[model samples]
Target: MEPQLSHHVEGAVATVVIRHPAKRNAMTAAMWRALPPLLEGFARDPGVRALVLTGEGGTFCAGADISTLQGSPAQAQTLAMAAEEALAAFPKPTLAAVRGHCVGGGAQLAAACDLRLAEEGALFGVTPARLGIVYPASSTRRLVSLVGPATAKYLLFTAELIDAARALGTGLVDEVLPEGELDKRVAELTRVLVSRSQLTQAAAKEFTDGRTDRDAHWAERADGNPDTVEGVAAFLERRQPRFTWSVAAPGSPSSSGSPSSSGSPSSSGSTSG
Candidate 1:
């Protein structure tokens, strides 16, 4: 099959799978270009509480397809950066479920997610040095934030792959699991995320990302919101809380699905690249 980004929503979780197994799920330029719009759509959808980005088969992304980088390297880098930025800016929580090689652009995308869960034997590397390409400043900063300058330099300077254990120790991945437990753990965590308050999640995302100016804005949103009241009542009654607030950005289409709604999901795929 042609390489593509395939997505499907099940309840509150939307999963985007990278499918280019012939090249170990390397992303093509078109795939990189498609990512921002896909993430924008999910950001607008009230029903999408969480997102999972992963690769087809057992491997995560292998980076940009080398053939596409042979010419117009700058253009390819631009598209990859755009995609990484989009993923980083997505309002909802996102997790990268990694199992195999995550290198170059692949590592870029994974690092953009809010969290990363890797299989025990997965490998990770930032490989711009291998191709003699200068990594973007923004990406370098993000890598530094996650793994610290020392660890980030080690990977960037040598383009050497690190095992999942070292990645977890460096904070490049949040969790590392045995081979068969990734999907189950991902599902469990996403279900917990879906059960939480969007008001809390959205505000925390902003503050943690260094947006100090949004305190009053989030406070205003929290004020008089039913989620707080419901949470208290649920605690008193020893019942599960039902968070009702959903993010509906301006100019985006509205959906009937609320934070607690279990609406039927739909799937789509794009084979452009």
Candidate 2:
């Protein structure tokens, strides 16, 4: 069966499931190509505030489907690049709810998300070395950005499968949960992410995504806006802030943000600034 990305919306959260469990949710070439559009759909959907990425059947992911590659190094690498581009460009807060065996390309997918939550016994590794493959530059840079060059080099060069605890320590996984508690923890985290002001989150993400690395004006362009002022007011008043998302809105005569009606913090993928 073909791999698919399924979405379910709950309040302000958009849960995206990687429903390719037969391959342990391993990414197929087609699945890699499908991510951007799915994410784009979520990016523009107002009902979605934050996105949760998880695999079906408790297994997070086993990376790319080697069988699909037919032992073609070039083909496998291409597939990885396709997946990398889409995840990296997703304009929202993305969380990876990971479970058993998040290794190889799966590890890279988790690394691409804004944050990651892993099951206690989940394993992580960059197995390119094991297969005599050269990792893509974007993935390599992202890994280094997360855990630093030394740690990135160690993981990539050794291809050792490390425990979830070590993955957390190395800045790979943000939080670790026991097998059964993963859902509860993710739910709580998702709630927190959705409740925050999207304005701040989006701008923060823009800069965080390294988009601001070469743009001196990015910070200035994103730090504050009308919605941010409203967020502050809402905080002081202890009321829900009415976020305006259109350029043609009552107070937002020139606004433009994803999720059209009003953007939740998730839409900012804030790394865009």
TM-score of each: 0.93, 0.83
In order, the Cα lDDT scores of the candidates are 0.87, 0.74
What does candidate 2's lDDT look like per residue over 1-273, in tens digits? 457766667866877766676788887777777665566666666566678888877788888888767767697678678666667666567899998888888888888889999889888889988878889999999999998999999999999989999989989989998779999999999988777656556656767876565244434534576676787799899998876442223433221233433432243221110
Q: For every model in order, what is the number of clashing pairs?
A: 0, 8
What's the C-alpha lDDT at position 242 in model 2?
72
The model with the greatest lDDT is 1
**Superposed Cα deviation of residue 62, candidate 1 (Å):** 0.3
Residue 215's lDDT within candidate 1 is 81
Cα lDDT for residue 41, model 2? Answer: 62
Per-residue error for 31 in candidate 2, Å, reads 1.3
TM-score of 1: 0.93
Residue 35, model 2: lDDT of 66
